[model samples]
Target: MNFKFHHIGIVVNSIEQYEKQMLPNKKVREVIDKIQNSKLALYENFNESYIELIEPLNENSTSFNSLKKFGNHLNHLCYKVGPFSELENFMRDRKWIKVFGPVPAALFENQKVVFYLNRNSQLIEFIISE
Candidate 1:
């Protein structure tokens, strides 16, 4: 199992607003679509992984509240991992709270990233890519 810092997910109220203000180049529209449709966006230097800008797409999304309160800023730090359950159980045994998902399946790629809301006042996630 190998691990790497895949991306930093920034929580924003509107992806449109951030893209217009931060990434106004017409050529970068594809990046925006990749995020909207794929839940991931690549940085300009494609060699690095990406900075995933996420907005609420559903009622269950917690990012909506974070966006409302923080007004678009760094939200979560993410790292890529393997064997998600091992990490999940480790966190659970340590008494950290699992807030969002351990959904067995994934929405983007073959990856399963679980969102955890901890008492230390930060949101953390673990990603396992298949």
Candidate 2:
């Protein structure tokens, strides 16, 4: 049940636009996750933390509504978890509802990820640790 801070997810109109303006000259890994219907970019900082920039692939994308409502803004916090099986019980105990996933994420080398919503409606993402 160990959880480690992994990254912050930000919804943006375009990952390329955000990278060019904010992460210029920084190395970034980009991928298209069809399961999530979004384009993603991961930038790892010197401190080993990461920032995940997400852009909707189309109007049907899950992120599309979020982007339209919040514009370019912080979307969620992600954590790396060691034991995937414990996630359900852990989240339920805290009154968090599963919103999306437990699906393979293209941006994470096909690793599984799950999304949850807390009582206050804040989103959280959990990626199964390697």
lDDT values, one for every candidate: 0.61, 0.87
| Candidate 1 global lDDT | 0.61
Best by lDDT: 2
Residue lDDT tens for model 2, 6-110: 889999998867878775435568888888889898988656778899999899887899999989999999998966778888998998999988889998899
Question: What's the true lDDT of residue 39 in model 1?
Answer: 36
Those runs of model 1 whose alpha carbons end farther than 4 Å from true positions after fitting are 23-47, 58-60, 104-107
In model 2, the clashing pairs are none
TM-score, one value per model = 0.68, 0.92
All models, RMSD in angstroms: 4.6, 1.5
Model 1 pairs in collision: none
Q: Which whole-number lDDT from 0 to 100 does residue 26 have in model 1?
A: 32
For model 2, where is the 10-residue window of minimal lDDT? Answer: 19-28
